[model samples]
Target: MPLLRLLCATLLLAAAAHACRDGGTSGEPPPAGGGGGGGGDGGGDGGGGGGAPTTPGWIERARENFEGGALPASAFAPDPVPDDGPFSDGGAYFTSRGVTPPAAFRATQPFGKDGWLTVESYSRRGDARLADHAEVVADPAGGANHVLRLRSQQHTDGTVVRPTAPLPSRYRVSLRAGFPAFGDGEAGGNNGYDAGDETAGPWWPEERAASQNGFYWLTILDALPRPHNNTWIHHHRKVVIDSDNHHPAWMETWTGDEFVWSGEHPIMMIALDGSRPGDVKTGNAFFSWSNGAWQPSGAIRAVDAYLPDRWYRVTIERDGPRYTLEVSGTFRYGGEGTYRAEIDAAQRCVWHYPVDAAEAAGAAGCVDEGAFVEGHPRWPAGGAWPDWFMFGDPHVNYYEGEVYYDDVVLEVWRD
Candidate 1:
């Protein structure tokens, strides 16, 4: 089975989200020259500079993992939450097609009730329940009738909620989020076992390969593969916008201490596969992970800023291949910033036949078989678009913390 399916199955059976291991931490700050900032054409070949320094070593390691057979079994853990109840009160709106813009297709959730949200634990170090970490209670701050309360206890936990229907091509998603003022000090060590405090958290052991310590994440799952021979193409396609409370560089291995505090930074990332301008897969070819491999197409860092006990509005809009992410509010660090990224599908590349076919033909034929070709007609079918939106720490591990979310709105465009 594919890695993602296996993960979902495991979580379904186990009744908790605990796939993947915790990442190790190093006391050293992310190497110099790693800061990310500034904005330009989101599709430019130039790597976004001025934020966190690039961690080439970590990237290389992730590449190796992608190429080296399947992701580690250790990486395929279970999500603690169950898929129960409706994702939204507005049914059938998500699947309605061709309804043009200015026309609103919204799924608003206030979190005042309990049936709409599903919470799961994503850590392996300790025993924690989704209910223990998440709750739908009256807002003490008196902003809304009910708010989604998420707490990161000894492990990194998350919650998943889908829309009433699939999202349209052009739409705006806005939500109010705040990190409550609470401190838990430090807890774990550097060797993948230590759960750091509010400042030191964990990252996905299988991807990115680092921790953000004390931060919040809102991930949107855009595309998913259909049930067919070529399903891997849609797996793991999503956008991740995270607030990095503790700036840590990606590590090549799990060999560092947990308490190293770097600083604070906010990041936006898009994960996809596509060829570069000068790559062999030019023309009609586009990138596809048919063989179960993925690469980060873009990682843009926003201004390094965030404040506790303050509410901020985060909006993510997708139009065609372009995505615009913005954050605003008193606690917002990047200001009323607009960051864009365009995915050039024409530059995608795909291998002909399978790796085994090339291997059977010897070195010369192997090279020919491995060559990039035009993407299939069904390359980016409707199944490859986002259908759900989620919040909280999906795949990161942390010691302890609390986050609050309210007033989520999803708006669809006509033109």
Candidate 2:
């Protein structure tokens, strides 16, 4: 069953690359590089089954564990505390869509009441009809059994975050997240996922960001206002398409912009930012567990169970220009562990990017090549801080489903 699951996922991965679309930006995956990326060669059972990573001396700056049943005052837009933003008079959002918001929606604040955080989308593209929602609700995965759920059948690309004052260049962010699970029987969600075919090799994850039904694409968590673009973690580093010296050697026709994990796999990809011209913000690592290894064959590795409904915690910490991405958690097909057994984060990887200069400069180098600082002229120096961590189709290419987030936190590294 595990082998079959992995096979089905790989088949879809290649197609996902070409099929994935992009919005709010016109860009393709980084051009093939002079060398293949490193780290894809190493991977193991990942520390025993379960729990989140640990960080010492990191002071928490902002946190949201939606146990209160509503986004706290810290989640809404800043200031004078009025009945707006997430707490609008009601229907404005739906009225724009030509539908009347339920009367009950008018009675209680559905979006949010007050908070230090707010919701924003990287792409302004919004659908009027399908669905659009953001609020706190019950969950079987959250540490507190509650979380902030955001969705947009309209596929309005967005993410939730806490507004803040700029701080030192170094900090860390962590949170628990997962897609909503339905169909208790086929319940875990990955009932019939197919990236297309097995042996197709690792395909670009982010497809064309145009109109999409919204499958969980990629998760971006990193410090913003800095040179490191967290979402860029989805970077394909080098598309390999339209080139001869590509690294993977298997995916030669691929031309997608990001690495799209099919499902049931704790996978990630990275490329050095400046490996080639126009490859700024690219990543330099890939972590798809498979065949008992991370990036076993350079693609994804499925767990013993299903994926869709499983929850996982992701944490990204940045110090200067360097970043570390850590993931933890176990998942069953659904919260009930009915369809299959619990899939521990056994295929997980604790990866750090931008290998040292000498190594990165090597043939299969993994290094960051962007140039920017704490307050570079490119990004405004001071003002309300931008979203530090966001989920739910941030690319604005295409996604029409909802995802949950809980115990979202931002912290500063204590020197």
Candidate 3:
């Protein structure tokens, strides 16, 4: 049964140049690098600077596990919150006060715990009209425990931020915050912020300004497969937004200007507008999760959870390739052994097949099998297929939202 289960589950991996097996020929001169050309290696060659390919280690591991019928049942490795001083997990966390920025913007202060350092927009693409600011600070909560805080607001035109440095691959990111919701429908709602810049290009609407849009709290996983943008991994959580309504908050993950996550590196974006344990759903808080993948993968479950207006800690650790989500110290969703067995027994589900750029470009990569997400409260209605949200444009995504992000940590398993 386990073998059958494993066999039934399809493996979704982004094609990388290294992943593309050489036609099994020795001394083959690699093809010339150019813009929009025919097949070179396999997938990763997505028309970038020299079209750099990715290492094929993780993909190989996934295939080996799947082909063997079931992934090795290793015990869930305990990810202990380190006892080192000053939010120091010793080797667990890398604190960077100096987060690099792109060419258009420079850091007012390198990232640090001393004071609130921020990045302001001076000009974008020779346009001096852009006005936006991002502030980051680290606060010492208790003995050796610190929280990193970030607030980004783009109030005017031509404001944007691309991380100074690329985040390590295969890391989980979660945030805690209160959001002021807006807009009635997905596109019209005043979520919090608006995105208007040249990068958004033709998709940038000069007339219709999107309100209730900006993210008060947003989580992003960086450096995923190209073409399809960030490699998004879905996770399950029993969360109640400020609305106290039963709708699940979206944990959207993306890379750069793209609102897609079909490649790798899934990020988490949750909505905690008005949710408290055993409390009445009062406020109207919400968020959305979307991706470019053909299918999405992850877990979403409920628990007693936490309350708003207070500091709550959410942690997720992947045991091997599987994920485990925890709130405070208890397991709410996605864990192993007792946790995994319980969640699976309670809810049987599947994810959408992540769309592949290589596959789209006619490579022998995995294509979309179907969108069969069970157990999720927001599962699209029966017989209705899940598709991408109409975010105006395809290439440029004006992600404008308001949220406070602190104690940001990322762990990548490259074994």
Candidate 4:
């Protein structure tokens, strides 16, 4: 078997043995944090003093109506046999946070309010088994005072949580996330696996190192409309940050280790379409690891950089097929500033060209050339809006890192 396939088969086997864990294996550092209030003012139909008003009735009633629900014991069956794959790599990792859909909570609709839904109860798939590492703790800043923290030690695991109800199509989601200072083995290092060992024989030298590169992601996902089979489509919009450039070729093949950014910067991306499971075409919008700064992805770029160890308000808004993302805080590149982008959904398509085609003609042999390809579309034509949204890292691997999230709020606009 080819090295890539062999590695994948090994991961699948590993996933089958365990429930999904969260953590990332690719990308560059995220921005530093130290400022207050960044992002564009919510406008269009939901415009207001503080953007669209929070979805009413969601905040006050979420705990009462949404909390305490758990997945069926059957839903927790070993990897791949359950409703979704048992492994935590793709949509399964995101949807499996607390309760799988089709359940009572999964069917709960928005309260028809224009306010925001606040998620207070957070859970992970193997928290009970990994209690020593994954947990929800009080935020040092106080107020609602709770935050979800995920730490990994020889394993690339993470935590996830979902709102009590589904989010509206036209909505703004906001949250605060933080990362610790980079350390050896925290970002990029072999996870104590000897390269020549029998167990490591299936992986390439680079794969072994890259697989242990510690990283984290803050993501938002939605179920796509499957008019073809009346099924569900899973897609992700995520912010990825790695500790260093030592990532697997499969994860960062287009850029490679040479372009790996410092752990302090974060890359924002949206995955639209692809052929393989969880193989969505990823497009970078507002950050780059190549230069250790925020640069434009197409016509969009970050006005400022992000910092580590500090908290910054990250917000995402969708208007029609266009998405506007904003980040505000102290940055290493642009100083106390805000970064923003206005992107169309069609811009996130993954492009393919004939190999051996000339560069002048725009063909670079099957390669992922970034986002905003003019003609290709990620979503199926005339597809319906997504029915669900999820947050957290879904890729499965073994690495070590920590990430924290707090003050998560999602607001929808109803006609």
In terms of lDDT, which candidate is stronger, 3 or 4? 4
lDDT of 2 by residue, 1-415 (tens): 9999999999987666656553212355434532232211121112212454533566665566766555432222211212222112121322343433221110112232234455443323322211235666778554547776766443223343433443345666667767643111122332222221212101122432221233232233223311111223233221110000111122211112333233222223221222222322223333333223334233433322325566766665556444455545553322332111111111221122222333223323322233222222211112112124434433222233466777766677653
Q: How far is candidate 2 from the true structure (C-alpha RMSD, Å)?
A: 23.6
For all candidates, what are the clash counts? 40, 40, 49, 30
Cα displacement (Å) at residue 397, model 4: 1.1
Can you give the lDDT of residue 159 in candidate 3? 20
Runs of candidate 3 with Cα error greater than 4 angstroms are 1-132, 137-152, 155-201, 204-212, 216-310, 325-365, 368-401, 411-415
The number of the candidate with the highest TM-score is 4
lDDT over C-alpha atoms for residue 6 of model 2 = 98
For model 1, how does the per-residue alpha-carbon lDDT over 297-329 read when each residue is reduced to its tens digit? 322223334566566676666554445555566
Sorted on TM-score, highest at the top, how do the candidates line up? 4, 1, 2, 3
**Sliding window of 10 residues with minimal summed lDDT for model 2:** 238-247
Q: For residue 14, what is the lDDT in candidate 4?
A: 87
Alpha-carbon lDDT of model 2: 0.35
lDDT of 4 by residue, 19-107 (tens): 42333332433234322223322212322344545443212111211112222121211233123322113234333344232211011
Candidate 4 local Cα displacement, residue 22, angstroms? 60
Q: What overall lDDT goes with each candidate model?
A: 0.36, 0.35, 0.25, 0.36
